[model samples]
Target: MLYPIFEYFDQVLDIPGTGVFRYISFRAGMAALVSLIITITFGKNIINWIRNKQIGETVRDLGLEGQNEKKGTPTMGGLMIMAGIIIPTLLFANINNIYIILLLITTVWLGGIGFLDDYIKVFRKNKEGLAGRFKIIGQIVIGIVVGATLYFHEGVVVREFTNPVSIEQGMVETPAFKDVKTMKTTIPFMKDNELNYEKIFGFLGDSATPIFYILIVIFIVTAVSNGANITDGIDGLAAGTSAIIGLTIAIFAYISGNAIFSQYLNVFFIPNSGELVIFCAAFVGACVGFLWYNSYPAQVFMGDTGSLMLGGVIAVLSFALRKELLIPVLCGIFVIENASVIIQVSYFKYTKKKYGEGRRVFLMSPLHHHYQKKNIHEAKIVTRFWILGILLAIITLATLKLR
Candidate 1:
């Protein structure tokens, strides 16, 4: 909304300060600051409302440390994050940009699903929350939407360079550019960082490429979303890690969107990728502000309400920039946490089937709980996880030159 006004002022009236909005860095910084103020200032009031409504979390006998103490903590605090992200994006971003529009839709769509789950848990008092199948269905619905959009939308196109440049001196060796349709994504530490999805079905030749690409997109979206949802097991852990990841990706998005940076970095130049920085700015601010209450002895829980959206939004952001393959490294914590559950469950089921009895894998499933089970202190666990997330972010960025 503000973009047009600033653009008009810059393009027509020749306004002095309004032209500042032309720089994505300036706008992103403003977006973060505005979102922070909105979330922090309105935080207490929203908490009070949640308290007044008795919309508190019902902690069961999970046997984890501090489990009983968490009972009755006000939840549904995802509203804070939503407010932080939405307001800034609306104010600082190019509202007409397809990427921004998609992000807004992603925020609202997944937020709706999460809000419904939280609602079922809070208002409906259904301890199980939204049915697992229904949540999965909602996530799949998002995957389809995102995948179809990326495939069909001309605005989501990518520019490919033949004989791509080396990562040395942090720069493309040969630049023969073409607007080619391919299913490539960035992968770290490879001879060629590009991992083409179409290559997966090499046996099928040309016809299998589209199917392969479509399936890969769906798989990535679903997996990334579920990874984020599972990682929400710890307070401040998911939110903080998300902010770190969002910030890192924002850098990538800016570089990718800028033709100069893209050429210097020897990477694909995405025309509209820079617009993602504004969306991610809102994302980072929302996570940090939410942490004000979500930290340690959390005042309010985000529940699935915020977790699902965080994951979905992150997934969509990466897909938009054609950087989805970087997710395993960028979101390593979420990946490990998710993998722990899948491994634990699979092993337990397999052992039970073979031995007629179940077995445990780490003391708990989500990996963070394994530390929690050792009485390692939740705050410490969350902090250490964040440190690892930072390291992963560094590695993800370092790939620009690490090759």
Candidate 2:
């Protein structure tokens, strides 16, 4: 909204200092500041409203220390996060950018799905909120939309040289480059890091490539979203980890969108994706701001609303920045948390079938809960997990040069 107004001010009105808004870094900083202000300042009021409406968390007796104390805390504080991200983006980002459009849609789409799940749990008194199948379907729908848009949109193109150009080839001088739409994505830790989807799906013929790409997109969106949801078991785990991941993605967006940096780093150069840096800035700020109340001894919980949206947006940004392949490393915490659950469930089923007695892997399912089961304080577990998340983030950033 404000992008065009600032443009008019700089161009038509010739307003002094208005030209600063033309810089992505300036706008991104403003967006992050605004998001932090909104989430922190108005968060209390939103929490009060939710609490007044009797929208609180209902904790099951999980036999974990201090678990019962969390019951009745205001839930659905994700409203604050959503407002923090959307309002700032509208005010500071180019709303017409297709990448921005898809991100906004993903935020609303996944947020709405999570809201419904929380609503069912709180209002309808159904512990099993929103059938699992339905949630997967919603995720698949958004994945298809994002995948199809990136696949078909003309504006979504990567800059490629007619002759193979590399850092070794000397990018000090401008080289002939053309923007073309393709299914190539960045694969970390390889010298020639680009992976074309055609190499894997070409056997099915050209027409089937889009289908396979969309299917991969759907899988990523669903997996990460569910990973975050399950990781939300402990306070500050999801939001804090998400903040780290978002910052890493924002760096990728900035580097990929800048031609000079892309050439120097030998990374995929995506046109017009710099706008995503602003979106990701808002995301990181919102998560950090929410952590104020979402941390240990929380006053409010983000519930599924914030968790699902965070994961979905991260997945979409990775795709937009061509860094989707780095998700396993960057999102290692979410992956491990998700894997713990799957491993436990699978192992339990196998043991039950063979020995007619259920066996356990960890003391509990998700890794955090296992720590809690080991008598580790939730705050200590959260802190350790956050430290691990930071380490993973650094590794993720190192991929920009490590390859």
Candidate 3:
């Protein structure tokens, strides 16, 4: 919202300070600071309002230590995060950018779905919430929209150079470069790192490639969003881990959007993707600030609203940066949390079918609860997982040069 006005003032009116708004770094910093301030300042009031309204989490009896204590805490605090992200993006980012537009849409779309789910659970008095099938449908719809837009939008294109450039010198002046639209994504730890959808769907022909790509998008959006929801099982786990992932992606966005950095790293230079840095900045700040109230002895829970939206935003950001393949590493915490439940359920069913009795893999599902069953403190479990998340993020970044 503010971007264009300041730009006009700087360009047309020759205002000195207004030109500073043109810098992505400056805008990103402001977005992060403003986002932090908004969440921290408004979080207390929102929590109190929800508490007074008696809108609290309905925690199932998991039989874990300290589980019952969280039963009636104020919930659906993700609205704070939504405001933090959207407000900053609108105020500091160029709203006209395609990347920004898609991000804003994603925040609202998935947030709305999550909010509805929370509403059903809290106000409607239905523990089943929005139904699993309905959630899946919502995810699929957004996935199709995001995939189709990225595939068909004229603004979404990657720059390819005709000549080889040395990564050491990092020359911006290349022999020639062309901005072309292709379903190509980055592959980690490979000398030739680009993976094109055309090659994968060669047998299906060029006409069928987009259909397959969109299917992939649908799967990714569903999987990651669900993964995030599951990871929200404990306080500070989801928000803290997501903040780390957001910061890492923000770094990637800044580098991918810069020609010099892209050339230096020998990576794909996505035109106009730099604007995503501002969005990511707000994302990270929101998550971190929410931690003030969401930590160990939590004051509020993000529930489905924050969890699903966080994962969806991350998924879209990865695709926008052409780094979707890196999700497994960068989002290792979410992946493992999701995997624990899948493994436990599959093992239990298989054991029951074979032995006429269900056997458990972990003491409880979703890794964190298993640790809780081991008599580990929730705070300790969260901190350990965060450390692992940081390690995974470092490895993910290292892949930029390891390739």
Compared with the true structure, the alpha-carbon lDDT of candidate 1 equals: 0.86
* Model 3: worst 10 consecutive residues (lDDT sum): 165-174
Give the backbone clash total of model 3: 0
State the lDDT of candidate 2 residue by residue for 294-344, as single tens digits: 998899999889889889999999988888999999999989999999999
Candidate 1: residue 54 lDDT (0-100): 97
Report the lDDT tens digits of candidate 1 across residue range 253-329. 99999766786777778877798899999899999998998998899888777888898899899888887878999
Model 3 segments more than 4 A misplaced: 162-176
Clashes of each: 2, 0, 0
The sequence of per-residue lDDT tens digits that candidate 3 reaches over residues 1-403 is 9999998999999988999998999999999999999999999999999999899999889898998899899999999999999999999998999999998998999999999999999999999999999999999999999999999999999988787544556644455778998889999999999999888996887678889889999999889999999999888999999999999999999999987789889888999999999999999999999999999899999988899999999999999999999999999999998999999999999999999999998999899999999999999999999999999999999999997
- Give the Cα lDDT of each candidate: 0.86, 0.93, 0.93
TM-score of 3: 0.97
Q: Candidate 2, residue 397: CA error in Å?
A: 1.0
State each model's C-alpha RMSD to the native.
3.4, 2.4, 2.0
* Model 2 TM-score, 2 decimals: 0.97
Cα lDDT for residue 383, model 1?
95
| Model 2 RMSD in angstroms | 2.4
Q: In candidate 1, which residue pairs clash?
A: 165-173, 172-266
